[model samples]
Target: MDKGIAKMAFLHLSPPSSSSSFLLNSSIDSIYPKRLFHLSSNQHNRDASLQLPSYSSNQGSRIPAQWRIGVSFFVPFLDRSSEIESLKQQLLDAIAPLDRGADATPEDQQLVDQIASKLEAKNKVKEPLKSNLLNGKWELLYTTSMSVIQSERPKILRPNGKIYQAINLDTLRAQNIETWPFFNQATANLVPLNQRRVAVKFDSFKIAGVIPIKARGSGRGQLEITYLDEELRISRGNQGNLFIVGMVDPFYRVPV
Candidate 1:
């Protein structure tokens, strides 16, 4: 079975946000798509809506050199399934205490450390990530960062709640949607710091049914893509937070 293609078949992209902006790279202008606007809501009694960016069908064909290094390692390692699942379970166990509003015990910290160690050992690519691999929606399964995990609160503590990230590779835009019974979303522009790291500059934040608030000044942070492939992604935030994500339905190709 082609698990890689099977994995891709299960991922999909979310509808682009209406008020989002793109941070395009100069080299790919010829293939870049235009931005589109549509009416949705009025802010402060004035007509307003989000400005969504459009992407072309052929954009994936224009893979840049920096991304090639990462893409070259995209093949799945089916033999490592056991190790992957074990690490994932360990990560969940490590973060469980934090989810309950208690500090992580020494044992829990050790598990987290183990997971990090395994990721670092397995990660072969030491360069910037391929944008195509990061495109589309991802469902957050676990996190080691208490802050982001705690943000889910009682909802995540309960069953049937989760977080989803919608990343638009064509425009370098990303949206993090946390659904814990209710939705809290944050939109940001992704700036590539290098082959392995990207900076996230938050633009707006909003709770379900509330008007989005513009983020003040610059609230930028970095994320290192420790592991990425068709089925899974592992990223570490600048603050040492770890995130484990899986692809969502309706996938696309990762530029080769």
Candidate 2:
């Protein structure tokens, strides 16, 4: 059961990583195990012999026998999964020095945007609003908004803990939460605007996870999910800000 930040933007060191570059690398490693490349020499020789020339769709040209050196040979180079993981690392490295974009300069933002655009172009979940990948507890990795990070506030008032946003596409609900120092949170309902967009209508807010206040008209806004996968998600807020988060829990649910 959780209630969170319905309309706030995100900022800060966030995920202890590029929200954790180390953790990101580890995740990629887990997805692609070494056993994939553990083909024995004997096995390679057998595979080489067994592979035959593959003809083109028109049957006018033939594929070299060497082109069929088993899936392992092509995994490191052509597997979309591996390619996605590689892009994730590149993105992590780009933001690892930005402090979840709290310290990002104009030039830094541009660089991050370039990389993010590439990921969005190859989004695995084309229609994120309807995919299970959209339902999860996503830890903020980088964002373009300053409000969520509270940079204008005196350091004392700035959140000293992590921020999280969770969603349940099935229920058309969402929440955002802060940890420690301030537990400010909010809850909202999601109205579908398109295949990848939603109009968010905030219903309530809780101060320090205790008090409750009903939402007003200002609580409403739009968000478009541009890119999504098993571990990463990229979103755009109504104000033209960009948000990048890494998935932590797929089964995350909002309290009904």
Candidate 3:
């Protein structure tokens, strides 16, 4: 069951290092065991896609500037790029402390989804399958797939190193790797579903980066590239898990 879900979704860009402290506080909570962060409060956040309206009250409550949700909320003249960048930072910060979502709650997942959906709405890349940006070694940042995180197992028993996925659209090949503990990996041939989606059909698995096993005929799944750019890529799995991975090595090649 763990191995089955591990193959769900994969891709992303590095999160911006600097985010508004207030924004981070509003969207995420303090970290707990297993690298889990509880969702204490998210009142300030409104859907980033919607034009957030100002609220007035007899009590005169104040909304943080980050959550104001208007032209002033972002740069002028509908420059969505800046807005997208801001939300992107927020998304990264929200998950940075969650340790690849080993223990993310449903609320935490919802927050990630809400922000990701907003970014998907303004995806800069119209056709991710053909984009050069899609070719690289992407560091797994956050995922709703617990199989990759191995949340049910103890941290010492789980792969404690960086998770990565590399692809070469030129060859129509994709590969996923875990860096430490066990360098478990898998390779797949991509069958394009459209300009923005593909079916990941596994060809082989590398146990600890060595022993190879032929993939079963059933080892295939649907993955849709929902958002993409030179620095970032967002995707969804057939199991409905969201994936965010940061580009780590643009020059990484899928081993032949």
TM-score of each: 0.56, 0.72, 0.72
Report, for every candidate in turn, its global Cα lDDT versus the true structure: 0.49, 0.62, 0.65
Give the distance in Å from residue 167's predicted Cα in candidate 1 to where it truly belongs.
1.6
The list of candidate 2 runs beyond 4 A from truth reads 1-79
Better of 1 and 3 by lDDT: 3
TM-score head-to-head 1 vs 2, winner = 2
Ranking by lDDT: 3, 2, 1
Kindly provide the TM-score of model 2 when superposed on the true structure, using C-alpha atoms: 0.72
- Whole-structure CA lDDT of model 3: 0.65
Q: After superposition, how far is residue 225 of candidate 1 from its true place, in Å?
A: 1.0
- In model 3, the clashing pairs are 11-245, 12-245
Per-residue error (Å), model 1, residue 157? 8.9
Instruction: Give the alpha carbon lDDT tens digit for every residue of 120-203 in model 3.
Output: 998878999989989877777788876556666677766677777888899988887766766667787888989987877777
Q: What is the C-alpha lDDT profile of model 2 across 1-256, one tens digit per residue?
A: 0011225333122222112100000012245232112122122111211223444566533545666575336544455655565666667767766656677899999999999998888786878888987886777777777656654556566665666778887788888777767666667788998999877777776666676767766666677888887767888876777888866666778876
